[model samples]
Target: MKKIKGIIDRFEEGFAVIEIQGGTKDCPKDIFPKDTQVGDVVYITGNQVEIDKSETKKLAKEIEDLMNEVWED
Candidate 1:
């Protein structure tokens, strides 16, 4: 078993679009936790996906800071 990091890009139909190292991949939505959402950082181990809450929050803050910088006058 191996652990891979990814971000939840979006949900479509019955799948979740995940951004991985090389590109994006789709996995069945049911395989993820029910509370999962877009922008969540996840760790994939075999067929299981687990949310990395701290990483997700850190990423959100980084993006927010970038956005704020861009909008500052």
Candidate 2:
């Protein structure tokens, strides 16, 4: 099985837009966990999708730091 790491970019209609390596892919929302949200990190292995909470938090923190730095006077 091929394992891919991606981020939940957005949701449109009944599909979730996942940003993976190189580009993005549209996957059915039902394949993701019920509590999954935009910006959450995910791992896709074959037909199963799993959220990576720690990685999500880490990425969020990194982005927040960058934004803070950019906005600081």
Candidate 3:
């Protein structure tokens, strides 16, 4: 397993585009937390950081709802 730091770019269906220190890759949004955002920094592990579809969907929805509420003001 490898650990790399990256910033969340956007949610695409069930994946998240994370801009890593050296390259950009797709990771499951659920791997982090529900509060993750476009600019939030994250650490990823494993050979490939892909996340499960069902979990990704659930977390993405939660993140979307949180963003909406946070930006409502």
Candidate 4:
């Protein structure tokens, strides 16, 4: 069981493409939870996927900080 975190980038052909820290992947709609949408954070392990609110916040903060650094220089 490999666990990873990612944000739902978009959906195509009934598959949801999740953007992770270093890559992206397409998850079948059947395995995705209802009410999930773009920008939602998710935790994936094997065939199951679910939301991780804390990890979402953490990733958002990291992105914000990176953007801040780029503009501050």
Q: Order the numbered candidates by TM-score, best leading.
A: 2, 1, 4, 3
- Stretches of candidate 1 exceeding 4 Å from the true structure: none
Q: What's the distance in Å from true for residue 57, model 1?
A: 0.4
User: For candidate 4, what is the lDDT?
Assistant: 0.86
What would the TM-score be for candidate 2 when compared with the true structure?
0.96
lDDT of 1 at 35: 98
Lowest lDDT sum, 10 consecutive residues, model 1, at: 21-30
What TM-score goes with each of the models? 0.95, 0.96, 0.55, 0.70
lDDT of 1 by residue, 1-73 (tens): 9898999999999999999986999999999999999999999998899999999999999999999999999
| lDDT comparison, 1 vs 4, better candidate | 1
List per-candidate RMSD values in Å. Answer: 0.8, 0.7, 8.8, 2.7
Model 2 regions lying over 4 Å from their true place:
none
Rank the models by lDDT, top first: 1, 2, 4, 3
Task: Please give the TM-score that candidate 1 achieves against the real structure.
Answer: 0.95
**Displacement of the residue 13 alpha carbon in candidate 1, Å:** 0.8
Candidate 4 TM-score, true structure as reference: 0.70
lDDT of 4 at 17: 95
In candidate 2, what residue range of length 10 has the lowest lDDT sum? 20-29
